[model samples]
Target: MWKHFKFDPNSVNFSCFTDEKFNKFDNLLRFEWEHAVSQDLFMFTIDYNAKQRILDDGDLNYIIGLNRDRQEKRRVPYLFEHVNIPFDNKKFHFNKIKDAEVLFSLDNEQQTDKHLIIINAAPIRPYHVLLVPYRELEQPQVIERNNLISIIFPDVANPMCLDSLCDLLLGQIIETKYVVTADCIVFGCEFVAASAHPYIVAGLNSLCAYASVNHLHLHGMYCPGRMFIQTLKCSVFHTKSNCYLLDSFQPQAFAFEVKHIDEFNKISQDVYKITNYLMLNNIAHNVAIVKGDSFSSADNVLRIFIWFRQSITNGEKFERCNFAFLELSGFMTMPDEKVYNTLTESEMCQHMNRLGLSVEEQERIKDDVKNLLDN
Candidate 1:
């Protein structure tokens, strides 16, 4: 059994997150979120007050959700124009929780150090929170190969990272319950593990990828939808494992699937090896891990999608539509109402493809990654 936070909805003081059974996490999250909203704890009240539409262009079902309120909040002066901002230069960090409410404070559990689960101040959805590991260590947004490897290997593993991923999946499974409508019909409800109710763990490696804070943290949003990346059209790229290149997707990405925990170590290594290379080369990237076969009644495989794109070195202005891990995964949040209203599928495709490497360059990258892992 995995450890879980002993959560309390009424406490302003820290609640201990320890090794308990993982049955009540979804209930805990929802309870506290409602409590926080009652106390007016968030920077903004983000009730589903935005325009949303879904566009199916043959291969992908694109969710175009516009959050006009969030767009207005981004106009703050401290917003920088560069991806590689120094830690000391930033006016904002997650070291201290402000405006948002804390759900739980994780102590030493399974040899994992301190961590925090705090609500997103500018939340995009209910139960949206940020998970910060080793808060005092003050790690940056960039991924260190050594640190990543330490998390994957059991001897030196920081299970907090892996546990966070599993928590999202497990929470989805546990949230299954029976509901009755006013019409007096009984129905079964099972939320999609990926961003449906509990949360999906997503990371943005640089500002170009819409990372607002330099401090190391992961976003857990309750985005409700079956993302297209969960089951993307793919052609096998490397014969070594379940590695494939997303076919016909803009900004070519490598997708790796992990069917069980035993396969996690090797799969994470392969995924991070490529990410490390991208970090060293000053390439911006986004990572999204979701239930691979989310739509299937019996499948529970997890898929890791990594996209390497052109770094936004100078942040003079934002991209036409900021493409982060979530956007790349198909659940897009358009801050600008105008862009959200007028954007076409073909135009969006062209823009995202241009943001990534050319077809020849991506082919070279594929070859390079295959060689790196094989040897």
Candidate 2:
């Protein structure tokens, strides 16, 4: 029943996961993943077969690529258009997982503090894995903000912890060979069971997202190229909070920043309140927590970008392209060569716009967010 969960002596020591330790663990993870792939444990070798290019779309320039091989190999049970799926216990979940897929387990002082680092059998990018916090808990796909942050990023309320988490993620961007993105996605499960019908999927592939497995996990993927969202400029949305709106970017999004540790509580509350409203309203959305563009060892600023978009339902005759967190964040992985080769900035913008709400609808959501925070 425990699968292959075993404490890794070299794994992160939660009591003190310094920047140096993070570097060591990253190397260890890559080594373990490569070893597993060599042994033919995974479904296929993780390769970047896509032809990539950077488009100069004025301020919203982005990295676009096509991975036709992954498109053929990866499992996509339902398209992004299928949003009203139920949480069926009969389906696969992290609670029941293959032993060989596990990288290792994180067991610190107590056995109950263990977490599983499992390889994504089918990955969108290299070095992809699910960071399952307390695998034994059998938590559902729902995102409980406080519980999630506490377990994955314990003591984040503390400035030191916040900086450490930022360094852990940013270190990947700087030291790793490939671009990386850390997305804690909530696809089909809403904060409340009553409002779950309008849930969203995070990744383009169903296995990577789309409630393929109803398990609480954070996706850590080393993408093929850098994403534009890391450096995209934004205008001030609300004069009161640290939130800023990504103006002029298709599928408008709101971003929150934490330049100083003292701003943690307020920013956390703001993110929670906004996401809570979106979930309750069944508004499909994506949350990306990454190191800020201005990040440095000296000034490690953290950023959180939230995008509330329209759910492409089954019956709707909408634009067919899937726009999840990665696509919205400006690093789209196309399903085929034609789409990748021909998707221009203007057309990409149109597709993104089609997947999102109108300006008026977004304004109303912003007002609702403001009201929630004010109360």
Task: Give the number of the best model, judged by lDDT.
Answer: 1
lDDT of 1 by residue, 258-314 (tens): 554445445666776777676666667777766555222344566667787776554
Candidate 1 — worst ten consecutive residues by lDDT sum?
182-191
Q: Candidate 2: which stretches are off by over 4 Å?
A: 1-22, 57-59, 78-86, 105-115, 146-212, 260-266, 294-299, 314-320
Off by over 4 Å in 1: 1-23, 56-59, 74-86, 98-100, 105-113, 145-201, 294-299, 316-320
User: Given candidate 2, what's the lDDT at residue 48?
Assistant: 49
Best by TM-score: 1
| Model 2, span 253-323: residue lDDT tens | 78876664345445656766776576667676666654434322234345567777776444233333566
Error of 2 at 76 (Å): 3.3
Instruction: Report per-prediction Cα RMSD to one decimal.
Output: 13.1, 12.9
Q: For each candidate, give its TM-score against the true structure.
A: 0.72, 0.69
Please give the lDDT score at residue 154 for candidate 2. 27
